[model samples]
Target: MDTPLISASALLGASPAPLLLDCSFDLADAAAGEQAYVLGHLPGALYVHLDRDLSGAKTGMNGRHPLRTRDEYAAWMASVGIGPDREVVVYDRQAGMFAVRAWWVLRWMGHTRVALLDGGVDAWVRAGGSLATDVPVPKPVAITPAPAPAMPTLDAAAVLARLPGLRLLDARAPERYRGDVEPIDRVAGHIPGARNRFFKDNLQADGTFKPAAQLRAEYAPLVDGAAKGSVVVSCGSGVTACHDVLAMEVAGLGTATLYPGSWSEWSADPERPVEKSPAA
Candidate 1:
C-alpha cells in the first residue's frame, strides 16, 4: 500500500471489508479507551487496549509500554483474528495517536496488510457511518510469522551509540521537547541532538493527514540529506512516534526506525545524557 491510511468513505464501501479495531486510549485515564469503545464504535469493530493489549509488562526499565515478544504478539494477533492473510484496519479518537501504535505493531510483527482509519471515529460519523455498541467475538486463527520484521526498531542503547551521527526525530510536543513541561515521564528534556517534529503536525485542521506532497516537503528538511533508514522517530513511551513513521510512509519517504524505548526508557537512566532547549 502506498499509504497506511484508509479514508472513512473508502472503508465503508470496501468489498470483503477488512477487520476494524478500535484503539482509542487516554494516557492519563487508562480505562477510557474501553469505556469509549463500549459506549459506541464502528459496526463490527473490536476494542484493543493500549496498556493491556498493545504493550507488554512494564519493568520501569523497559519503558512504560514495552513491546511483547514475537511469540506473545503472534498469539495476541491470532486471538484477535489477525493473520498473514487478514487485512486489518485500526483507529482511535485522538487522530491516529493510539491507533497507529497498533498499526506499527502489526507491521512490526510481520503483518503487512493493515491501515489506519483516517480521521478515526469522527471521520466515520462524518462519512454517514453509524455506531454499533455490540462487540463481536473474533474467531481465532493460526498466524504465520515472517522471517524478518517489516518495521525497523531501535532500543535506548542503540540510539545512544548512534548519537549525533544519526538523525533523531522527537515526536513529542514542543514544550516537552524544550523541557518546558513534562507531565508523564520522569525527566523533562529530550535526547541530545534530536529535533522536535510533534506528530500532530502531520495532520490537517480536520484531523486527517495532509497531502503526501506537503508532508514530503515538511519532513524532507528534517532528514537533512540522510537516508530515510538513518532517521529514527521517538516519543514518550514510544507510542506517538509511530505517527511519524506512518506519516513518513504516507509521504512516500520510506520507513524510519522506531525507538521503542523513547524518552521514558532514556530518562529512567540518569547516566544517559538529556538535552534541554533554551527557555523562550
Candidate 2:
C-alpha cells in the first residue's frame, strides 16, 4: 500500500469496498467523460469532472486549472463523501492522464489512503470486471484538512526565485517543449531551464505504468542529482504534471513539488523568459 497505485483485480476482491471515483476525461470534448460515465462505469462509482470539480475557476493569470484553497477543497471532498477514513480509488480510461490529477489533489488534501487504479477502467474491463450505468448516492462526511507532509507545490514567483538551481520538469510533449506546436497554450515555448519529460513516457504500450526500477532509471536523467523537493513537475496547467509526480513516487524517488500554474501561467506573463530549441 506504500505505492500510489492499486490493480483492478486487487480492488475487485477487497473487503468493505473502497470508494471508487471515475475520472475519465477527453481534453477535446469536456462533456464526453460524463457521457461515457452515464453509458457505463464501475458499480457505485462516482464521476469526478476534471474542469468542473477538480479545478478552481480560471482567471487570466491563474492558469486553466488553478489551485483550490485548502479549506474549499476540504469542503468539496466532504461533499463527495471523502474523509480521512475512506480508502479511495481513482481511475480513468485515458491512461491515467486525468485520474492522476484527482489522486494528487486527494493526497494534497492529506488523504494518504487514496490511490490511483492502475491501468484505469480499461484494466478493470480486461480483468473481467463489469461496468454499470447506475450512479450511487454518496453520503457526505465532514473532513478536517490535515497537514500535507507528502504533497508540496510552488507558485510562479517561488519557481522564478528558485531559478536554475531548481530542477523543473515539463511534462509536455517534446514538440511542444521545442516550440514546434502549442495547441492549447498561447505561447509555444517552455520555461527557460525546464527539461521535457512528457507524462506519456511514464506509461507502457498497454497504458499501464512501467515497472518501478525502469521508471527510476528513466527519470534519472531528467531529475539529475536534484533532491526530490528541489524538483518541480509541471504540464499545460498542472494536470498531467501530477502523472509525473505519481511516477516519481512509484519509483520510490520521494515526493516532488508541483508547479500548478505551469506553462499556461508562465507563458501568460511576457516578463518571464521562455526557451525553445533552435528552429527545426
Candidate 3:
C-alpha cells in the first residue's frame, strides 16, 4: 500500500470508503479530545481519544498507557464502523503526535491498510477543506481484528536475557533519557544500556516525516553490524516510540519490537537497573 502519509487535499477528495479518524488529544488536558470533536473537526470524521479509546487502564506498574488487548481494540474499531475494506486515515491536531499512536495500534492489531494524515489538521485547514460543527455518529459495523504475529518483544526477563546483543533505543528527549528531568512518570532515568533517540527527530519542520533515504542514513549507524532483529525500541511510555518504528519502516528497515512496559514499568521494579549516564 501507499506509505502512511496522505496529503490533506487527497484526503478531502477521497470517497467515504476510507474511514477518517480524528485522534486529537492532550495528555495534560483529559477532556480536550472530546471537547475539540464537539466544537469542530473534519467532515464525517470519528473521534478517538488517546487515553480512553486507544489505551488500556493504567495500573501502578503497567506503563503509563499500555496497549489495550486485541479483542478490546477490535471491539473499538467495530464500534467506530471500521471494517476490513476501509482505508483508515488518522490525524491529530498537534503535529502527528497522538494520531501516530493510533496508527501504530492499528498496525499492532494486524491491520496494515492505515495511513496518517500528512501535516494533520493544520494541513487540512490550509488545504481549504470544509469542516463540520456537527459531530458524526457512526453506525456500528462488525470488525474482526486478525491475530498479530509474535514479533520481537521483550519482557523484563527477556530484556535481561538479551541485554548483551540487543540495542535498546529510547525515544524520549535527551533530558528525560538522561534522568535530569522527568515530569510524567514517578521515577527518573532510563533503562540500562539504552541509547536516546528523541522521537521528534523523525519529522521535518513542516510536520511531515523525513524522506526514507534520509531516515535510513540517520538510523544506519545505530543498527549497523547487528543481526536483522537485534534492535529493541522503548520510550517514556509506548506511545511516541512508535514514531521511531514508523520512521524505521519508512527507512525500509524491518519492523522492530516494542517494549510496551517501557521505562515506567521498568523503573517501578527496583530490580531493573537504571542508568543515569549515556551508554558508552
- Candidate order by TM-score, decreasing, is 1, 2, 3
TM-score of 1: 0.97
Please write out the lDDT profile of model 3 over residues 1-280, one tens digit for every residue. 3786788888888875478899988889979977887788888889998888989988888888887878899899889887777689999887787888888888777777899888888888999987788877887888785586434566767887876656888999899999988899878898878878888888888887888899999988887876655678999888788778778878888788888779888888887778887444
Candidate scoring better on lDDT of 2 and 3: 2
The best candidate by TM-score is 1
Q: How many residue pairs clash in each candidate at the backbone level?
A: 0, 0, 0
lDDT of 1 by residue, 79-127 (tens): 9998778899999999999999999999998788999999999999999
Q: Please estimate how well model 2 matches the true structure, expressed as its whole-model Cα lDDT.
A: 0.89
Poorly placed runs, candidate 3 (over 4 Å): 150-152, 278-280
Could you tell me how far off, in angstroms, the CA of residue 209 lies in candidate 3 after the best superposition?
0.9
Q: What ranges in model 1 sit over 4 Å off?
A: none
The true-versus-predicted C-alpha distance at residue 42 of model 1, in Å, is: 0.5
On lDDT, the leading prediction is 1
